[model samples]
Target: MPVLVATVIGLTLIGTTARDVVSVNPEIATAATVFCGIFVQALPFLVLGVVVSGAVATFVTPDRLARWLPRRPATAILTAGVGGATLPGCECGSVPIARRLFGDGTVGAAALTFMLAAPAINPVVLIATAVAFPGEPLMVLARCIASLLTAISMGALWAKFGQPRWITRNLLRPTQQQDSRFSTFTEAARHDFLQAASFLVVGAAAAAALHVLVPSWMFDHLAGQLLLGILVLAALAVVLALCSEADAFVAASLSMLPLVPRLVFLVVGPAIDIKLFAMQAGMFGRAFAIRFAPATLVVATTVATGVGLLILGAR
Candidate 1:
């Protein structure tokens, strides 16, 4: 294929360029490692998500998911938020699944809730938060409550105001003619992987550049300023585009800031970030992603701040 040939040529050029660049600027080498690390850490989850989403596309009808959920819209959204706990994976896998589940009307809200909640409220993420902030279990509790609240709020918003037109018709459409179920699943998985993974490369490149360019002194100056700290860390979370399973460790490493910003980091990273935005744009559409991502960011940050002050302050 043309893409395959172009990629091979690009990589060959990069292999030659990397040797020269590393000799000139060592930071480029370090950034490359971080770039590769992000992709390597995310690929398995991406594959899992595509497979899960493919299965959902092939087997789970809209009526089936609708039947499984509560009849009331608000209850269904909340249930979906809670249901996110069942899927133990990072944000990378949740996007495609969300797209697959997004049917017309209220069911779309539940799917979106699950997309946001699964990465943040899942046991693996909570355990990582606990380990990251030892003796401060409040951090874990705050993260869960804040992330769940954000998911629920977004679901509610979508139920009230969402225009299905924002999402591409391709997302809601299934293949009319079925081959074998296995064949359908494989085709869906392969298509999703290619789309999601290609965008992930863009996100990973942005993250690597930000990782290298962000000055360490910036954190030193953020002490005692809660609002500024929250904003900066939220922005950093978006830029770093870290895997939800691992972002807590990175947040913990930033001991310079207060618990609130770190809490904001955990809350915002899983809910809205560069990588998730890219995936959403690919799966849904640019219109949906642009509106949804900023809303999620504001909700996550606000909810995390409120929860952090309550739980962490009480302790």
Candidate 2:
């Protein structure tokens, strides 16, 4: 599927270039320049996520995690949600870690919750939000509340209606063992890095194209209607698929949009996006990814809007 998508994109670029649809040197050159920077910025975090995910997968025994976790479901969910703050990497990195946890026999719903919450609610993201919103601490609070609420809500929904059997059979297959934990960890890390780095390349190319082709005036036209702006930003989040570490900076640069809409950008981004959807589709079954991704989109957008308006007043 990724190959097909990439082929389509390449063909489109070729067609456009041949037809002079976009400026010859300027557009391609601009895209190349922007993508180079974006790729460099995102690669390190991708590497970090893969390493941590691999380590967790290869070395961290399920028994160890289970022993440390609270026995109660609610406690476990809340702990996982709040524990997102401690994870140092962005949303892109969280996917592999969450998958590793599930594969290693950690709770599926709980791991999913952590995947969504941790990137957005973590200290790195929070600090980025704080910097982005500067004097408006409420923006940071709204982002946190929205992230937690969305994660918890999705978790509860999965608990009630999700087919654990599907997860068990398709998504969380156990990793093969090796004689040495150190060697296993290194191997897993290398595998994860390659996988994530490839996806990051795809995402960066898309983001750079959008940056070059989409006019800044586009956002300006949608500024006044708060709900509309939030919806638009939510869609943009899916398309941009920016790293959580840098998304706030992007949001900050979009000074045309109001605080509430930008807040939605931060809240919904880590939970759902095109690159993430692609990654999830690969890791989980296609049917499962389809349902889960949309579910998260609806929930995250709704929660973000509600929290944003409640905290910051209706824009």
Candidate 3:
């Protein structure tokens, strides 16, 4: 029956004109392309993340991670934010790595910090920001400062109010397991990819829909107002669900908006967007994401606004 259906579908495709269908409703085709682009772009990074996560599961223990970090949560969170530069990937990659590194107490806080900071502060993203806003070196600086501040704030907040019970997913445990090392690695990677990828599809679809639905005139009008621009762009960041590595260009394209609001968009997108929110909610829990995401948006926006004013001189 499946084979017959497949054959019929293949015949129908051969008989039908795809171009005519697209000509009738281009939005559907455009949305599909956008969705695929997002999914494809994140695939490599997601794979790398899960592989690293698997390696951590197989080799690195919580006690080892705990011993490597500072004794105090505050200090460790700061350190993690700084150390985020070492990971050369986007937010999609950091989620699994952070999950692998997450532990009880200070380690968890540090891991959360690293997760928020890594994609935003990494050299690739910084260079992209610099390139996007040429002659505006301060934009790059503002982005770095705001992103680090946001990351550190979230880490500190998590240390104070985040409860482990809120996280539904647990890190893979190598001990008390019967599987071979290679098998364990493969399993972990497979599980992380499937889970993250599924939610990623949902986010990508939503983003594509927004791209098609929202009018360009709406942005032009909103960009004229300072507070409204910042808030709208911040919300746009969440809605667009752009990859951190590429978001600078997207923010830069919003030339109608002032530097400060665009800066807020860049800062807010990587720290907490639709895609990252979905991934975090899956890895953490709805309870945690509900609290954490809003706080991140607030902190990121405030920090970006302040840093932008100081650096860009009210521009």
Query: How many clashes in each candidate?
Result: 0, 2, 0
Q: Candidate 3 at residue 29, lDDT? A: 78
Candidate RMSDs in order: 5.1, 6.2, 5.7
TM-score of each: 0.70, 0.71, 0.69
lDDT of 2 by residue, 114-147 (tens): 7898778876567766765677888888988999
Which residue pairs collide, candidate 3?
A: none
TM-score of predicted structure 1: 0.70
Error of 1 at 296 (Å): 1.0
Which run of 10 residues does model 3 get worst, by summed lDDT? 57-66
Model 3 CA deviation exceeding 4 Å by range = 1-66, 174-220
| Candidate 3 per-residue lDDT over residues 89-207, each given as its tens digit | 45765776688778788888998998899878877678767766787898888899989988998899889888988777665656766788899777766665565555556556765
> By TM-score, how accurate is candidate 2?
0.71
| Global Cα lDDT for candidate 2 | 0.72
**Where is the poorest 10-residue window by lDDT in model 1?**
169-178
Q: What are the Cα lDDT values of the candidates?
A: 0.79, 0.72, 0.76
- Model 1, residue 38: what's the lDDT? 63
